[model samples]
Target: MALTVHSRFHPIHTDLAVVTLTGDVDISTAARLRDDLAALLGDGARHLVLDLGDVSFMDSSGLSVLAGVFPLLRESGALALAAVNPRIREVLRTTGLTRLFPIYTSVDTAITVLRAGDDAPS
Candidate 1:
């Protein structure tokens, strides 16, 4: 399945960029994902909320892209994941990446946390 990425500034919290992704994130799509993420950061998004509820699968390449952008977000902003599917969650847990991201149950919750500056890495 082809990956689709939708990016926009949070409606209420302009400082936060919300990216909603669907389909599989693997070798074929990791680069695009990385580019999109980098673009958001470069566009001056200080906080990000990734909504992964529609994403069905993710592989190592996808994880790598996420990890690569993590430090950038940490240094200049905040990053959070919302509505992650089970498959992706398992991958993150197995790879011990769960500690690097703040995972929330919903996009609204993530937006709130990020807007309040509560999702910063500890």
Candidate 2:
């Protein structure tokens, strides 16, 4: 089955952008995610919260896109992942990426942290 990724962007506060993702993020959909995120950053988004609650899967390609964007986001802003499923969380943990990205239980919590300027890696 072909997996389709869907992204929805919402502006929170003044500088935070929330991108909600649904469906699997594999080779076929990683590019779309990257483009969507790049567009948000291009639009002057200084803080980003990726709500991955509906994302059922994410492959190495997806992880690559995220890893590549981390430094870019940090150069002028912050990025956080919210509601990541257990499978995806394990991937991050196993790859030691858990240290690079802040993971939250919900979008609201992520937004709150970013808004408070406490998004620095812990």
TM per candidate? 0.92, 0.87
Which stretches in model 1 have alpha-carbon errors above 4 Å? 118-122
Clashing pairs in 2: none
Tell me the RMSD of model 1 versus the true structure. Answer: 2.4
Residues 1-122 of candidate 1 have per-residue lDDT tens digits of: 99999999977667789999999999999999999999998888888888999999999999998889888878768888999978789889999988998899999998887766654556
How far is 48's C-alpha from truth in model 1 (Å)?
1.1
The whole-model lDDT of each prediction reads 0.88, 0.82
For model 2, what is the alpha-carbon lDDT of residue 110? 88
- The lDDT leader among the candidates is 1
Residue range 1-34, candidate 2, lDDT tens digits: 2444444445337567888887888899888888
Pick by TM-score: which candidate is best?
1
* Residue-pair clashes, model 2: 0
Error of 1 at 21 (Å): 0.3
